[model samples]
Target: MSENIGDLFQEVMAIKQAGEFELISALIPYAGLVGLELIKENAGLITILRNKPSNIGNTTIPAVHGGVVGALLEHAGIMHIICECDTTRFPKIINISIDYLRPCLGTMDTYARGYVIKQGKRVTNVRIEAWQSDPSRPVAAAHAHFLMG
Candidate 1:
């Protein structure tokens, strides 16, 4: 039998404390979501922020959409909080909050890193930053609270 994709992905996850955003991106449905490199540090942290070609019909001024950025943060947060707890299962997200700091410019993709500030029996708190072209300048930031199921 062929090796399982989940098994392969899990193997990939085991190797890199920092996940492969490109591979992860492939699994994500959003095609516009380009996987940028990690900009910050802290274990179990994951961030996906990036710019894609202006489809023109999507948004104003050809910038990344807020919804995509929000979804990225949510995904990053889930990846992060779960890393903090090596349980027999993946943590579920009750909800997430993302605040846009600025409009992401340039043709480059932005990346965010989410670190767990708190992980308890019921919930987890994550903080993430989204930046592009330069990590020093972040286009958006988010603090997410995830309810562990």
Candidate 2:
């Protein structure tokens, strides 16, 4: 099953189209569970996490779970690598550090985008930011390192 996942990832990476990119979240069960969607804009690709009742962590404030936000940051970084980098295999995460700046409202969708800081032979560094209502005010930001073997 893992081998099949690897093959699917490689195939998707080879195509690298907007529609084909959407298959990535579907390929990973956890991503599907979290309702992650990929969108391609004039600037670049962006990720959206559709809010659902299951994702709500704070009932009083109705905020999104911290873990879900972290997952979005990590996934955004990986998606950026897959779309921008020349690689045959899926990148393995080395370490990820995230900062939650504001509460992500659970009533609306969350958007995230990643930028590649540096791409080395075996490691890639990416920065991701997630926002709910406005792009200027980010709800969370993250830095991640992936081992692209």
Candidate 3:
């Protein structure tokens, strides 16, 4: 199987159809392994981390793993850039800073949305927020910079 996500990205973007954005996650093994899905919404696309037993970290609190939350935040930013930006290649992460505001329940699905703070020639800055149950109450938030070139 080809592992070139950029090629797949180009193909998907060319189609420009709703529901095709999920294919972008297929080229990313980690996203598939974690059951990440890109959902097209009225506002824009949102990333969802499906609830799974493996994602649970604290059995008592039944919280999702911190690593899992971080991964979702990062992937949300990537997907946002891919779907919204005019890029032929996958963006590289320059740096990311994430804050965990509340415990993410592993039993429930997690949703994340990213907004582009700035898109420059060489760098793009994005802010992502993850929430469960309610969008008003976010479980985690992240700010990430990606190398667009």
- Identify the candidate with maximal TM-score: 2
| Model 2 worst lDDT run, 10 consecutive residues | 1-10
Task: Return whichever of 1 and 3 wins on TM-score.
Answer: 3
**Per-residue alpha-carbon lDDT of candidate 2 for residues 77-143, written as tens digits (9 for 90 to 100):** 9998988888868899999999999999999999999999999999999999999888999999999
Superposition TM-score, candidate 3 onto the true structure: 0.90
Residue 76 displacement in candidate 3 (angstroms): 0.3
RMSD (Å) of each candidate, 1 decimal: 4.3, 2.0, 2.2
Deviation of model 1 at 103, angstroms: 0.9
After superposing candidate 2, which stretches have Cα over 4 Å from the reference? Answer: 2-6, 17-19
Q: In order, what lDDT does every prediction score?
A: 0.61, 0.89, 0.89
**How would you encode candidate 1's per-residue C-alpha lDDT over 31-126 as one tens digit per residue?**
333443332344435464545564222455556767777766776676665445654355666766678787765355667667778877777777
Q: Candidate 3: lDDT over CA atoms?
A: 0.89
Model 3 is weakest, by summed lDDT over 10 consecutive residues, at 1-10
**Count of backbone clashes for each model?**
3, 0, 0
lDDT against true structure, model 1: 0.61
Clashes of 1: 3
TM-score of 1: 0.67
